[model samples]
Target: MNDNSKVLVALLAGVAAGAALGILFAPERGTETRDKLNDALKNLGDTIKDRAAEEIDNLSSLKEKIVENIKTTLGAAEDAADQAKTSATEPA
Candidate 1:
């Protein structure tokens, strides 16, 4: 994974840990505590899914741009070669 992804994962882990610890320590009934923790976990999961989707889209866009640049470069080279060949064949 990239540095940005690593950092994001670490930050998320820290947040999850903190939330769990905080909920565990709060003076509340067992059912209430479990419910709160469950909600927190669900929210975290949704955030992770959203971030993953965004990253995938970003990567796809980058890939497309790279492919386009390569194609353009190759096309320019081919055109230059064709011009050079035509110039060589012309009478003086």
Candidate 2:
């Protein structure tokens, strides 16, 4: 896990803890409080899922870019080698 991901996880944890504490301490009926807490948790879960999907997509794109770059580099190297060989074989 990168630093950014670790920081994000820590931030999310703090927010969830703070939200839960706030909701528990607020002056409200028990049923309503429970309902609100449930809703908040569900929303947090959805947000995490969405973020996870975005991260997966980003990683996939990075992987594709790395693969493309490697291919390009290898192709260039091969072309350079072929040119060197052809020049060396030519009568001088």
Candidate 3:
């Protein structure tokens, strides 16, 4: 996985731990607590989705850069082969 993936995982783990602790220490009755937790979860889910979209964009850009570099290197190699072939076939 990439750096963004690692960071995202760590952030999600921290949020889950914090949510668990909030539930353990909550002061309200069942329904109220459930409602509050549900709201919090919805908000957190939205934030997570936004961050995940950004990470996906970063990953896509990284992939493009890698592919471009490969193409450039391959082109250089092909040119070198063509030069070598021409030298071999020409008069000394």
Q: Rate the local accuracy (lDDT) of all candidates.
A: 0.98, 0.93, 0.86
Task: State, as a TM-score between 0 and 1, how close model 3 is to the true structure.
Answer: 0.73
Which predicted model would earn the best TM-score? Answer: 1
Highest-scoring model, lDDT: 1
Q: Tell me the tens digit of each residue's lDDT in model 2 across 1-92.
A: 89999998898888888888999999999898899889888988988899899999999999999999999999999999999999999999
TM-score of each: 0.91, 0.88, 0.73
| Residue 51 alpha-carbon offset, candidate 3, angstroms | 2.3
- On the 0 to 100 scale, the lDDT of residue 29 in model 1 is 100
> Model 1 over residues 1-92: C-alpha lDDT tens digits?
99999999999999999999999999999999999999999999999999999999999999999999999999999999999999999998
When sorted by lDDT, best at the front, the candidate numbers are 1, 2, 3
Where in model 3 is the C-alpha error above 4 Å?
2-11, 20-25
Screening candidate 2 with a backbone cut-off below 3 angstroms (N, C-alpha, C), the clashing residue pairs are none
Candidate scoring better on TM-score of 1 and 2:
1
- What is the alpha-carbon lDDT for the whole of candidate 1? 0.98
Q: lDDT per residue, candidate 3, 1-92, as tens digits?
A: 77867887798879967986697588878888778778778878888899879878988999999999999999999999999999999998
The per-prediction tally of clashing pairs is 0, 0, 0
